[model samples]
Target: MLNVLVTGGNGQLGCEIREVAPEFADKLRLFFVTRENLNLESESEIETFISANQIQAIVNTAAYTAVDLAEKEPEKARSSNVVIPKLLAKIANRHKIKMLHVSTDFAFDGKSGKPYKEDDLTSPISIYGKTKEEGEREVLKELPKAIILRTSWVYSKYGNNFLKTIRRLGKERPELKIIYDQIGTPTWARDLARVILKMIQTKDLSGFYHYSNEGIASWYDFAKEILDLSNLKTKILPIETSEYPTPATRPTYSVLNKKKIKQTLEIEIPHWKDSLKVCLSELD
Candidate 1:
């Protein structure tokens, strides 16, 4: 059996991986570690764990995901997103193990009129995005074979995401104003988790790739669908991004092109709406 180590065991993608891990139990031996159990920021600790367990592969899901909060805490963001990935890449290279790192679409400036491909130029606008972009660079530099999976607008039943936020607020508020201009696809974390597990098991699979649900939607559109799925009566008013200004500027259009991953893995991607329905059902 292939021994695999999954960091960030408590986050959305990590939690989803845990939920679906039993399906792959026959072929994979998965060990999960969160901040409570493993100090990911500590280099010696990570190195020791990987060596002690003889880990064959690693799925690095840990990240500093607070977008707006990152603006004020750039040091913390760099520590989590940059330094940790760099360290992990170095260790994985030494251990000669496969590594898959999760990244975000915010790596782009969102000025592209078309969907972003794996090779597109990245011009990050915020601290979080910049740090993520830097982290990707570090991983690639340290281990060129490491897989960098970039995704957008991730949500799940386990974490604080747009879907959960809208669901909670839609229940309490009569009306919610959501940004409609900024557009991207909503990715269910469970889908991404499954894809990562599959990728880890497949050998000689490395480099940059993109994955998200097939369809696109703005924040307002996503919120509307969530409220509808939850059977909530809260009215959602569509507003421009300027109307609801945030500390970190979001991409006006950050939809990722999934053609590379689709063709490479031959995996079918569910539409955002369809996956949203399934996720809402799980939440219920």
Candidate 2:
């Protein structure tokens, strides 16, 4: 079996990968490492692990994802979001290991009226976005073969996400207010994990691609769907982004263009609602 090293083993994406890994057992031997076990900063540690496991591939799910908090603590975010990926990319390249690095839609300012393409100009408005963009640059420079997947509005049953948070809040509150101004697709981590496995199995090496669920929605729309599907009685109110200010400014539209991934990979993507239902069903 080919050994694959997955970072951020404790995160939602990482956890989802673990859940789906059994299906790929015949081809892959995945070593999911949480931060406690795998320190990304130390080169010696990364090298030691890669050498010990004879890791042939690396799936870098680890990243600093707190958008608002990143604005306040740019240094910590930079180290985790930018430096860690860069270091890992360099190591992966040195060892000639296949690498897949996850990025976010925040890399865009959401200025594009249409969905964002892989070649679109990146103008990050927040520190988190800037750091993530920089990380992408470093990884590409160091390891051109590395597959970089940029995703948006990811939620999963495994970790603390919008769906989980809204479920809890709806149980407690009769009404919920969600931002209607910001629009994007809500990506389910399970779907993403499955796609990553496909990429690994097929040995598809597209340099840059955007992966998110089909269709578009605002935060308010997403909230209503969540409550409706979960059979919660909470009433949802539509509010503008101005009403809910955060340290990091979100894009008014960050929908990723899926044509590249769809065309290149020849894979079918599930509709956001269909995948949402499956996730909710699993959650129950």
Candidate 3:
């Protein structure tokens, strides 16, 4: 069996990957390690684990995902987003192991107001975005064959995510004011995990690719659907980005175009709302 090491073991993506690992048991042996245990800061630790386990492929889902806090704690973001990936790439390359690195759509400035493609110019506006973009570039520099997957608005039943926050707020608060101006697709962690598994199994596709649930939605639309599906009575108010000020400047539009990934994988992608319903059902 091919040894697959998954970083960010306790994260939503990592947990989701574990949920899907059983399906591929015949081909892969997955080892999921949390960031604390993995300790990307210690090169010796990483090297020891990879070498000892004879890890062939690494799925790096670990990242500094706190967009707002990243501004205040830029150094922390840099270490996790930039330093960790760079170190992983260097180690993975030396060991001749395939690496799959997860990135964010925040890499782009969203000035185009369209679904972003792999070749499009990146102009990150926030510290988090900047670090993640740099991480992607640095990882590719070390491992040219490494797969950099850019996904957006990720949520899942596990971990602290938008969907869970929405559900909780919907139950606690009578109303919510969500940003309607910024548009993007909400990607399910489970779907992304499955995609990663497919990529590992196929090994035919590589490089940068966008993966998110098909279709577009603003934060307001997303919240409305969440409440509507959950039978919550929360009144969702649609507001512009200016209505609610955030520490980090988000992309006005960061809907990722799935044409390349869908065509390459030759698999049908589920619509955002459909996936949302499924997730909500599972959550219930």
Task: In model 2, state the lDDT of residue 55.
Answer: 96
Off by over 4 Å in 3: none
Across 85-133, the per-residue lDDT of candidate 3 in tens digits comes to: 9999999999998999999999999999778999999999999999999
For 64-167, candidate 1 gives per-residue lDDT tens digits of 99999999999999999999999899999999999999999999999997999999999999999999999999999999999999999999999899999998
Best-to-worst order by lDDT is 1, 3, 2
Residue 249 shift from truth in candidate 2, angstroms = 0.1
How far does residue 1 in candidate 3 sit from its true spot (Å)? 2.0
TM-score of each: 0.99, 0.98, 0.98
Best model number under lDDT? 1
- Candidate 2 lDDT, 1-284, residue by residue in tens: 77999999999999999999999999999999988997889999999999998999999999888889988999999998889999999999999988899998999999898999999999999999999999999999999988889999999998788999999999999989999999999999999998887776566484889999999999898989999999999988999899988989989999999998998789889999999999999888
What lDDT does candidate 1 reach at residue 102? Answer: 95
Residue pairs clashing, model 2: none
Error of 1 at 78 (Å): 0.6
The alpha-carbon RMSD values of the candidates against the true structure, listed in the order shown, are 0.8, 1.0, 0.9
Q: Global lDDT for candidate 1? A: 0.94
Clash number for candidate 3: 0
Error of 1 at 200 (Å): 0.8
